[model samples]
Target: MFTDKLREGSTGPVAKFLFIIIMVSFAIAGVGSYLTPKMDFNPVKVNGNSITNGELEQQFRLEKNKLERQLGKAFREQAKDPAFNASLRKQTLERMITDQVVSDHIFNSGVVISDDLVKNRIREMPEFQVNGKFSDAQFRKVLSLAGYPSPLVFSEALKGDISKEIYLKTAFDSGFALPDDVAVMAQILSQERTFSKIDIAIDAYKKNQTAGEDEIKAYYDSHSKDFLLPEKVKVSYIYITAGDFVNDVKYTDEDLKKFFDLHAELYTIPEKRTVSHILITGEDAEDKIAKVAEELKGGASFEDLAKKYSEDSSSKDKGGKLPAFAQGVMDSSFEKAAFALEKTGDVSEPVSTQFGWHLIRLDGIEPGHGADFNQVKDDVIEQYTKVQSRELFMDKKQIIADTSFENPDSLDAAALAANAAREEGGQVSKSVQIKTSDFIANGDEKAAFPLNQPEVQKVMFQSELRESPVNSDVVELGDNAIVVVHVEGYQEPAPKPLSEVHDQVRDAVLTAKAENASGATLKSVTDSLAKSESLEKYVKDGLIVISGPATISRIKTGDVDAQVASNVFAMPTPEPGNITYKSFAGNNGSSYVLVLSKVVDPKLGADSARDSFLNNQIYNFRYGEDNQIVINSARAESKVEYNENREYLKMQEEQNN
Candidate 1:
């Protein structure tokens, strides 16, 4: 559920806007804002604001960790490539630059976020909340764990983020899609283009693309790093789950009462009303409703009068009866009248609403009530047991953490210490057991229980743990589970021998050769087409096939090659009696030469759903584009400089080759 919420928070305009602000806050704060002092190298300066190397390194690590958690094994593979690492570093620095510029712009624009708002925002985050309410202890604990020396520094960083959020919200909210704008966008998006494609399959070039033994061997020797086995680890762990202490908990009647008193709202059910209404709409509804109310006051059976006079088709036949409903679920006026009744069978006076007039009768009332301790004793005990069990779990968790840290080499001491503490507390629970796992590779999706979790994987694969096989710090799997893992076996990545990977190297060499041939073929074809050579000759000679002259829209391209269709639609339409030609390589080892023949703009008919979706898409795109333009303009206008000699930014000599 938390993962889903985080995913949701990473999407849409406001979420994305807040995400950027938060990332900026992280870049500025660098986790331990209070502890960070002056640094020697300032990696970059935005609007004369220096971004120190220390801050950049921290931000880089944060981004790298987030990416690893998100991309999992894919990121591990990419990390092997020096180019990928270089690009990531550059991208991280660029993000910091963008953030600094945007922050400066927002503050200079006179946007203000109050201290109260910042405090409230912090309070609202789930990380600092306990039982749906903000906890000061939790807040301090989380911040301390996150390496913030104090709340003041984090608050300062948060204020800046909140200010940016307010500025972005105003900017985004100021723009909206007009009907005319939406119509024009719809016509353009739904516009059709007629184009022809010449597809040169790679097989034609691959026929003569063979690599000699020496060439294959040379490639294998040079690119040995690319064909390495992933690093693997086997771990032994001791997990403490909440259930381990639940059976050890003992609760009395007094304890249950205390728990019930503290959480009475949890057991309290909302008041509900089973109501019936005679709705009189149309002309003279007021007089008609009054007459019905008068008849009800005259002691006529309310149901009979409703059946005879009510005009609500859905309820009139059923004696104007409605399902039981609670407050906030009915029309305001209707709910007001229905809930005001003191007892069942009470009839309300005529009430006016947008639906005209309603004369309501309360059929029954289920008044909201808080359960007494005796009434919900079992429930109270269950909750009490859970609370005590969690408290006990925390106690044991602390012991495990201390003992594991002290031992550093094994979990045997941690388990014994926890169970010993449990027995000292007069608990009769089973001793915690040490569980061993099969060899798990870095970011292995198939890793079994406990190890399957990303947080565990992260700690298990930490370089320090691999370098010196030791007990890791306690990792919380969720609210109920905590674990301490120790590396029992570790394997470093090594290149595959030529004897084992010869076929793979030969395939790579052939693929490279085929790619080169495809590039050459594309250049020759493009040159020929540019020189006004007839495409009919290539088709007649069976060198390429002409796929389509079919008219296709952006969303409705059918059977046309994806790359060909994409290029065709993206290309500008030619003037009358002229054609535009574009050449590009296909992802499927083929080359494409596209001819855009004609364009047509066709307006869409009235479709509320499609129109709404398109309007939102257009609005989001334009607003996001506007925000980006603002950042770009600011960056361009700002005095931005980078440290040329920064070690992290430079590619290693080996990678340079």
Candidate 2:
């Protein structure tokens, strides 16, 4: 079990801030710095083999950018907070590290995915198919569109992904068990005991305790390091969106026609036909359907009769009208009959189907036609113009980045270069402060200040403020544009003084002291319960004893806390006087103490369902345990190095004073 331990009450606002700072600092450092002098940008160095930094960064950025785009401006803005970004980076790095570890282990274990398997998997992919069969053209087109150099490389990457998935599955497969084992386990798990439990309420203990100012101050002085705040910055930024470009571009008739001529397939409409049906439901309804078919053949009104009896609510109200449908949209028998009709207003005989009987009418037909240039002109012009504008933006941004780097002193020179790249008659927007911080923080979302986006954020954070005044590399923003960001400002985090948060420190100390006292009280109660043996005696003596054995699984049971359940399962089997302890934080400055009775293991041959249940249980346990072993081994083998810069730590110490 990957149990997440809750932080103790010693955590204060200042301590939390420091934690965030350290996490963020580490995250930034992970991406920006190498783990060891001998190691390059690789996240993992396994027995001299490395997973390069470039590969990890590329994958991370691609995934990050894809998410930013999908979430749009609102969600991107929410994700843009420095603290959020820092957390995201940490999560990403941790995942990368974990993946690298797993990958290294897999390789060392000699697990391999064959080329034949890769090919078979690719064939199974729906995207590489047309008409339910794999198409080489489609496969190549998709691979090209995705920027994969070749099918072999793409297949190899997929193989690696598949191998990792298989590895994990093999590791975690233990959690499931056979039905027989489950039945036996359930019986043992559900077996009721008459014993009662005396919970030493932490809240009661806390209410009895009182802390003086001197005691609180003394606690604070001893644990002052827990009260120091980390450095933080407040920033304001603005961002210009790519969608804004849609409003500025104009579509001319000639441009539209040209676009349509170049991409005619996009505007072609597929053949479609309107259909209607009347269903008769029951056993042997086919005989009744044939009689209706005969009546239709005799020219009985299809619409009037359908209205009186049609079971399909969608078409019944609209005179049995169904909107135009193409192949595969309707049932096979219905579709075959509907499409076989030679002309509009054709009616089919009552047909036998899973729905019983169907009297289908073909109301209208729309023949497939290649759209005329004039008909699709506007759409073509919009698409082509946007594509052109995007290219133009990239070209202009590149010139600005290059020229600015070459001539570090003149902002005018960069602007002129940018303006020069634009087409004649095209108006240029005001010069925006393009900084890497803006792109990093805002992603694709509009920023409060233009320079705070990720593209800008990267440059601002990476470039030396004094030495590298301008960044020359073109920062690509999706497939739309590439923009260069210039560093405008720099701010370093500073620690806050102890006097600023003395009261907060005092409160934290009090809470910690209370928790300690409560823990001690809980231990005493549990010890007493063990000595007494009968929980009924404790209840009679005034303590409340809550009695009931709970049914639970590894997958959380809603009634009990997950941590509590985990701890309970870890205890030894029931024997009189045996006691186990578990604690959890509670609401309103309170805590919970759980006194556990020994678990009763099920008899192996107790149930007829034991075999199946045991199988599943064995599988689940083996998988979970093996996975943990793999993870632990990987962690132990990998190396992690933190930055030596103690400026933040020093500030924290000063603040504590």
Question: Any runs in candidate 1 off by more than 4 Å, and if so which?
Answer: 1-179, 194-200, 243-254, 271-367, 371-386, 421-425, 452-458, 461-469, 527-568, 576-579, 584-595, 603-657
Model 2, 1-657: lDDT tens digits are 223223452377776888788789779877445554432333444445554546545555545665654576775666534445445555665666666676778877778778888899887665564433667976885665455657876786688778876777765555466565566556655643222233544444445556677776676677766654432222222222344455445666776777777666567675678877777766556776677677778888778667767777877767678889765467766776777676667777677664568888878778767887766666777678777666555555556667867866535566666655157767775533332332223132454433434444444455353245554344443333344444554444333455676667666655666677656655556666557554555455443445455555454354765555655566545566565654555545554456565444434444433444455567767766786788788778766443233542332121110
Give candidate 2 misplaced runs (Cα > 4 Å): 1-134, 141-149, 158-241, 248-426, 431-502, 533-556, 575-591, 597-657
Q: Count the backbone clashes (under 3 Å) in each candidate.
A: 0, 53
Top lDDT: which candidate number?
Answer: 1
TM-scores for every predicted model:
0.57, 0.51
Measure candidate 1: CA RMSD.
16.1
The worst-scoring run of ten residues by lDDT in candidate 1 lies at: 648-657
Write model 1 residue lDDT over 1-657, tens digit each, in one string: 999988877778988898788789879888566467544356677776788766766666666666765677898667644346556766887887887787778877788778889988887765564433677976875565455657986797688777766887776663668888878878877998998777876565556778899998999999999888888889999987777888778777787888898877667665677989999876578898998888888889888998999888889889999989765467766776776776678888899875779998888877667777788888888888988998889888888989999999899988887877345557544557899998888878788866876667877888888678789877765345677899989888888889899999988888788777667666777787778677666566555677777899888988876766778877987888778888776686556788888888875578865766777788789878877876887677778976565342332211111
